[model samples]
Target: MALTGAGMSTASGIPDYRGPTGSQRKGSPMRYEEFLHDPEGRRRYWARSYVGWWQIATARPNAAHAAVADLQRSGAVGAVVTQNVDGLHQAAGSGRVLELHGTLARVVCLDCGAVVPRVQMDRRLRSANPGFAEAAESVADELRVNPDGDVDLPEDLVASFVVVPCPVCEVGTLKPDVVYFGEPVPKDRVERAYDLLELAPALLVLGSSLTVMSGYRFVRAAVRRGQPVAVVTDGATRADGDPVLKVAAPVQELLPQLVSDLASQPDDDSAEPAEALAASR
Candidate 1:
């Protein structure tokens, strides 16, 4: 099983939270509690998201994503579990992928349990607020786009911005389907990831700091089960000292080479499992 994170999509124009060139802007991200209770916070979130959504929506799969797909197709990998919500793994042709965090491509109505495509929400927001996108863009010159499709904006502008409610249930609040900080990942998603990890002989970690417990728990579980763990990322991670093989390199440059090397090796029916192979290295 392969576990991926934000760094996997950095080449595709997404920013990571704690990479070498960490988050470009500084501010607290919207918390689940604030979003649920504070109308003003929700308004600010949607206001920034209205303009920033285009960046994530238009992004394409990069080399790292394609290499993972190649590994899966070559029968080198069985399942993919990613902490990223960008849907790049699916976009790159990887199957049996588990999105640890819910995707930003969808929105849910808080009051009515109605799920809607983000594109439709974008269209509705655009129609409701003419020239708003242009205005936000002009002021966002100094702001860095976040992975969650949010950008730093002046407080005054945020106050002036308009937020659209769910179209299906007029009174319900609409929010992206992502797992927010202070919110738990869905129980079923966690169970599915654990099941995949239990079946795999090894776990390959890519582009994650594993700072959050949500992503770190899998690493701990794999270690407890005696699964060989390989980490391919550019910087320090919580699992740095634990992996059997740790490579400090960018995934975009490393994954393609790794995939090629694996493809060139002659197939050996009696070859050792991935855990043994990694442990030997």
Candidate 2:
């Protein structure tokens, strides 16, 4: 099984929260509480998201994503569990993928619980705030998009942006389907992840620092179960001090090599797991 994080999509132009240089550059992501009760905060979020959506929307699956899909098809990887809200895994042709957090392809009404495609909301946002995207582009050098598909902007710029109500209820605010910081992943999602983990012989962690419990808990669970854990990333991870086989490298370059090495190995069920791909790292 494979577990991926924001780092998996960073090669495709998305930013990660905590990877190489992450300690120095990572910004605080939006929290669920502020988005739920603070109208201004929510407005700011939507405004930034409206501008930053292009980065996430236009991003293509990178080499790492393609390698994972290749391995999955070759029977080297069985399942994938990712913390990314970006749908790159599915975009790369991977099957049996589970998005630990929700996806950005959808939007949900806070009051009515009505769900709609993100493109639907995008069209509405475009209609309500004409030239807003172009205005943001005009000051492109000033904007820094984050992993949550938002960027910090000048208050004056955000103040002029218009927000629309949900079409179904005509009163509820709409929010991205992604799970925000301080928000819990739905119960069933966690259960399904654990179930998949229990059945896999090993957990191959790619591009994640495992900084937060949201993704780190799976590492702990794998460790407690005596499952061998292999970590591939460009920086020190929370799992470094643990018993995991740590290999600090970029997943974009290394994952494809891993698939090639596995394909070259003799087809022996008795082959050792550690010897299967660790040499490639």
Candidate 3:
């Protein structure tokens, strides 16, 4: 199984949290509590997220994504569990993908439990607030899209932005159908990931720092089971010292080459270690 993170989508224009080229923006990340309890916080979130929508929506899958798909097609990699909510793996034609964090493709009504497409939400917000996005365009240079697909807009710009109610429940809060930092992943989803890990021969972690327990727990599980755990990322990671093999290179450049070498190996049935595969690069 392949476990991926924000670094997996960095090449596709998404920012990672701890990578060298990671996001460097203002304010704290959105929390589940803040979104659930604070009215002003939700207003701020939807406003910034509205402007940042184009960043993730227009992003195309990059080489790293294609390489993962290639590995899956060749029967090397089986299931993919990604921490990203960007939906790039699907865009890359990868199958059996489980999004650890829920996707931004849709939004949910916190009160009525009605889910709707993000595009539909966007269109509604645009219609409700005339000229708000264009007004923020004057400070376009200041725009920085965060890891969760929200931008760091100035407070002044956010203050006047009108937030719409959920269509299904006129008063229910509309939140992106994703797990925020302070939120827990659904129990069934976590168990499914563990089942996939148990089924796989080795655990290949791509582009994650493993800073958070959401992805790090799998690494610990793999070690307990004596499964090979390989980390391929550009910069330092929380498990930099614990992984069985650590390849410090950009995955976009490394994975494609690694896939080619594995495909061409004479002993195709033999499982080549990630260290050996990376060494060929």
Top candidate (TM-score): 2
Q: Once superposed on the true structure, which residue ranges of model 3 sit more than 4 Å away at CA?
A: 21-27, 267-276
The TM-score of predicted model 3 comes to 0.94
Q: Which 10-residue window of candidate 1 scores lowest in summed lDDT? A: 272-281
TM-scores of all candidate predictions against the true structure:
0.93, 0.95, 0.94
In model 1, which runs have C-alpha deviations exceeding 4 angstroms? 21-25, 269-281
Clashing pairs in 1: none
Predictions in order: lDDT: 0.85, 0.88, 0.88
Candidate 3 on 2-114: residue-level lDDT in tens?
99988889888888767553344345789999988998999999999999988899899999999999999988899999999999999999999999999999999988999
**Cα RMSDs of all predictions?**
2.5, 1.6, 1.9
Root-mean-square deviation of candidate 3:
1.9
Q: Which ten residues in a row have the lowest lDDT in candidate 2?
A: 268-277
Estimate, for each residue in 174-277, the C-alpha lDDT of model 2 and write its tens digit.
99998998999999999999999999999999999888788898899999999999998998788888999998889999889887777776777534545656
For candidate 2, the lDDT comes to: 0.88
The digit string of per-residue lDDT tens for model 1 on 73-174 reads 987788999999999999999999998899999999999999999999999988888888788778766656787888877888788777888888788899
Rank candidates by TM-score, best first: 2, 3, 1
State the TM-score for model 2: 0.95
